[model samples]
Target: MSNLIQPGETLRVLVFGAHPDDCDVSMGGTVLRYVQAGARVQFVSLTNGNKGHQSILPVALAKRRQDEAEAAAAIFGVEKYTILSHEDCELTADLATRRQVTTLIRAFAPHLVFSPRLCDYHPDHRATAQLIQDASYIVNVPHWCQNAPIRGVTPVIYFVRDSFRYPRELRPDVLVPIDEQLDILLTALCCHESQFFEWLPHDKGIREVPDADHPEERKAFIRKYWLDVRKQYDRNRFFSCLQERFGEAAKAIGHVDAFELSEYGNQPTEEDMEFLFPFPVYRRETWKTTGQRS
Candidate 1:
């Protein structure tokens, strides 16, 4: 087998989200970068997103979200997109769920794992974070997830961007510019018809919904609405760190995604950050002089 399957030989990133579109909406751009850099990446939804739709039944909504997730994964060409059968709005970080998550981490044996932060308002988001955190260490224990073999190294865990500030705000350790991949990231999000073009707009209390028949108009609306939302989350944060990695090109970067290293998992050193995030090489060090940080 290739080194990708062997533990610690390759860089593997596995991202877990509470709902179907959560991973795509949060980390899609950065995951696309990882895929481009030949690192194996996987997106897993801890819940099936059954309760995401307002009108659709839970079973049908679950299926639709799974289909949407697969479509999005194809666009990014990631290795796996797994939507667990747990119902939405009801995720709990119980032992069984912890073992289930542990199995996934053991199966992938990733070097990097990302999930939502625990400070979020959503219960499922909090639960997903708890599950991943609980599994962070057990994934390396031989007897914990008995069915799945364990890897020697514990995967580094990161919290996907969140603006919540109850206990503390998210502290970004790595900031990545994804301007070139922004279109692809947006396109990947458009795959989640139920979430982006429909449910999210309705959830946000948008009065005028995008027309379903006009795919082009819907896509355009999706782009504009999400881009506006993204600006609030991504556009204005982390200039100093981005400049350090990306050089002065950080100023021109209209779109970006960030990761906050979690205290529960492996603490990555600077070298690990360089290999894991790989922004300069992604653009092949194009800004060799002026745009580069002094």
Candidate 2:
């Protein structure tokens, strides 16, 4: 069967991330676009984010992150959000992990699955990527996981971009313009209070402190940090990728989410990508008219 989503069909999408905030940080805009288009989307975090904070205990931190993830899912309008009970930074692509992934794949039976790239800076990210790849084929096998029903076909899979600059370069096959969705994306990402307002800043040695107990102060701190630091440093790479693909018009694209086709899953054509994204073609033409190249 063709992997193209049929007319008027609601696409079922599943995205896997290493931690509670990974999916939202990486692809929140794309996920929001999917939801706005009426697609059913599910986000799965392989780890419970137990060690994400500097001060919070593991158990308390896990619960806080889970609640934050739930709040983010609500913001994104995601149909389902799950955080597996795996410990932070300890995920591995072992047989047990593969089985758990396969069971989820069989249960969700998604049309498209999103995973992190293998060459990530974090161990859990790399392990989650490998686990997803390993489980893609077995998801269709009838007897692989007896607890879950078998899926006749494996979902088309793609890898979300990572910040790591090693092993292999990222070459994206699809670029979804997220300029209009930036506010929504930021809103969803802000839901991950532990990560954005606490852990990340601490990890990076940024001195702008976050008061997790004070909601208004936390929001202000996160906004300042994101705008002054994260947006320029991290998000610029995404814009550069877009400019490479879409030319100077891509500069008009304030933000974008990129994906690479994974070899371990069903292959999709250029037309399939176009169908899946469904962004305005006129934006490209508009770039030609007013862009620096033209």
lDDT minimum window of 10 residues, candidate 2: 285-294
Distance from true position, residue 277, model 1, in Å? 1.6
Colliding pairs, model 1: none
Worst 10 residues of 1 by lDDT: 284-293
lDDT of each: 0.77, 0.76
For each of the candidates, give the backbone clash count. Answer: 0, 0
lDDT of 2: 0.76
Give the candidate number with the greatest lDDT: 1
lDDT of 2 by residue, 30-95 (tens): 888889887789999999989988999999999999999999999999988899999999999999
* Model 1, span 45-85: residue lDDT tens: 99999997779999999999899999999999898999899
Task: TM-score each candidate.
Answer: 0.88, 0.84
